[model samples]
Target: MSRTRIVVVGDVLLDRDVEGTVDRVTPDAPAPVLDVTGVHASPGGAGLAALLAAGDGADVTLVAPIANDPDGRLLTEQVEVAAQVVPLGHAGRTRTKMRVRSGGHTLVRLDDGGPGTPTTVPGDVVAELVDAADVVLVSDYGGGVTRDAELRARLTPVAGRVVWDPHPRGAPPVPGVRLATPNVAEARAALEAHGRHADGCGGPAGPERVAARLRSAWGCAALAVTAGAAGAYLADGGQVRFAPTPGRADGDPCGAGDRFAVSAALALARGAGAAEAVEQAVVDATGWVRAGGTAALHHRPGPGTPRPPGRAGESLEALAARLRARGGRLVATGGCFDLLHAGHVAMLQTARTLGGSLVVLLNSDASVRALKGPDRPVQHAADRARVLRALGCVDEVVVFDGPDPAAALARLRPDVWVKGGDYDTSALPERFVVEGHGGSVVLLPYVPGQSTTAILARSATGPRPDLEVLR
Candidate 1:
């Protein structure tokens, strides 16, 4: 699929995760002097919404404020993953939140920085990007990103297709937008501003009532109310559909709501039905945020190699079933990986990045020996499996005890087939097999010095390390 660019506008902030373990009480004034374990940073506010879009295969441009200060530097650094960032100078401080955690529970959170009103963004850039965007998402976090009337006026014209998480106090959008994604609270406010009957978070006119009213009030084609664990209320042409979130919605709800918004936008951009669209989004939201508070689109290099996008993966058949059911796509590749090196990681990452789940055709002990001769595959199959599983680019692992993974690929026909740069697509013996099932083949990057061959060469001249002893 070609790139689907999305423009996300509004508040952009930084999230500092201060994680630690608390063993004993603090010697300080009534505070737990917890032993800090580590810290991680993530993009918050609209930056997070942009992150979700980027993670879901959308070329996202974050059009938010960068105050041109130290905190602005942090916001800019945090949102470096986007395709383009529109910095709004003059807003002195970039909003930041530091959350203190203990035993996976957030004990306290201290917020730094404050909202700043954006004055301008490089010429008519906002309008141009909005016009070019396949989907536009408004993350009105009330962080002063969308406060300008002129900016809103310019942006409203190109709202042919937009998924808005509207700020409660922002001005009304331009007419003719396709969809508005709001929680129950913001829905009431937006709708009530147009003289409709609704209340924030859900009151007299709940989601169903507000969705119906907003469609006419703002000329929105559809409306979706993200009800958190109660799922979501989707309405189009006066018809309402309530899609419930998964059972695991009770998990860490840190940023899952933002994930749901972006995922829903992506699904709609892909032309999915409302319920189907929300289902995919909810899945992505709960899976990522519930697990690690990470946005869906991960950009980390594959095992420090030039791997594909979705390299780190899980079950193949299971993933395939989910994707097939929802029309999601996937890619697959195989390798011996007796020695995990950059080349192998790079190859797997690229394979997954092409799109969807990357099923690794693993070489069992016997298969590696058959292919690479004796004294190879020092690591046991189970140990190799664990190593391969650790890489984020690989989704599923299938161990073939004999040899040749074509039989395995035939069983699970992925949408795309990828191999390392060492071989041409023509030389892929199963290329036809994949094509027979309507799958395409591509060659991935080959990182030098990251090969088993290199390791073998180095070992020949010195004391060989028994890296496979763990297996």
Candidate 2:
């Protein structure tokens, strides 16, 4: 499977998070003195979007103006970790946004480095990148990148392949772009800029109306107006649609928009419909926020630090990305595992030896009931998962509601798909999916005479059952 090519074109900035506690006030003034603890830095604006796209396994190229300054060097160092940088001629100092935070809440934000826009646009280079990209994401951050005439000229011809994330102070999207994503506030402002009243609340259909008007005014094929935790409203093909967030997410929404835009761009690259892309974007954005947003980026496990056991609500995508960054092979196997016996234990232990980590895709209780009879699966899905995760060989346990593990396999995209030797690898439905992603299917020998059904039958008879049978 070749990687999807993504080009992120827009402004790049430095983001600095100063975490501390505000415990004392100065005697001379009422200003609070922060006892600084740590300062974390990363790329902001389109650089962040590029890094996110790369984190999702996309072949990302960042085309942005970066100034030659200390902050610019810092931003470049972070962005280069995940993306290839194509620097445009930049003027002024590197833009930096510093937030003073304490106890998960931000006290103040200081913005510096005014207007780091491109002074010289590389027209041919920009055109070549746009021509080669599967999806071109214009992550306008109200910087002067989007206003560059040469860059706009190159992007205008490839509008159909572009997903524009518009800003309040940025130029409008190129005419006939595939999609334009703007927050509700930006949408309202855009409507007013185009001579419409921005204050009118059109009942429950207000977002829909706003999205439609923006799409028409922007001359884009589709438009989606994001409303933070409330989700997004999309207008496509002369119809209005709403895609609500999967659930109520309560966390910092610092990079939610970047998450939304990048996911939508990737979905489009994967041949999804406009509505499907919007829905997926909303879900991804909500999940990102729920997982602590940008703060979660710095939570990598250090050297000799053991990985915590996988639990419910953990981000499987994030775990996979981290493992992939280490250049390690990922192994996966799925089963009902109704009873954790020697057979299950042996198969899992062997699978772990084939790769750096093993992810067990446990079937949900409902799925087990469908596969087995109604009286089957003595243990529920949660208990089964808990037991599987307790094994030293298992790195993560994911419970799938489907009758088969096809959907789960698609998401994990493991390098090795393992199963019991009782079944033929050629006859496994999962074999096709595994091979489609350049992975191989392996079959480990099943432990003979050690079956869950047999154990259950023996348990119903009496307490005189041999303990050696479980071994």
Q: Tell me each candidate's RMSD, in Å, in order.
A: 17.1, 13.7
Instruction: Give the C-alpha miss distance for residue 245 in model 2, angstroms.
Output: 0.8
Candidate 1 — which residues are off by over 4 angstroms?
Answer: 27-30, 188-206, 295-471
**Please, what is the whole-model Cα lDDT of each candidate in the order they appear?**
0.70, 0.84
Clashing residue pairs in all predictions, respectively, total: 23, 0
Residues 1-471, model 2: lDDT tens digits: 999999999998888889887889999999889999999887889988997888778999999999988888877877887789999888899998998887667889999995877988879999999999999999999788899999999999999999999999999998999999999989988898988765555433387888998899989999999999889999997899999865455556898899899999999999999999998898788767755677656564542221111112445666565445444699999999999999989999999999887878999999999999999789998778767866778766678887789877877899999998678777888899989989999988989988898889878886544666886
What does candidate 1's lDDT look like per residue over 296-397, in tens digits?
122243322211122133234434553454334777777788888877876777676678556677878899998888988879986787677666666546
TM-score of each: 0.61, 0.67
* Candidate 1 Cα lDDT to native: 0.70
Locate the minimum summed-lDDT window of 10 residues in model 2. 303-312
The model with the greatest lDDT is 2
197: Cα error in model 1, Å? 4.5
Model 2 Cα displacement at 252 (Å)? 0.9
The reply for model 2, stretches above 4 Å from the true place, is 199-205, 301-471
Q: How many backbone clashes does candidate 2 have?
A: 0
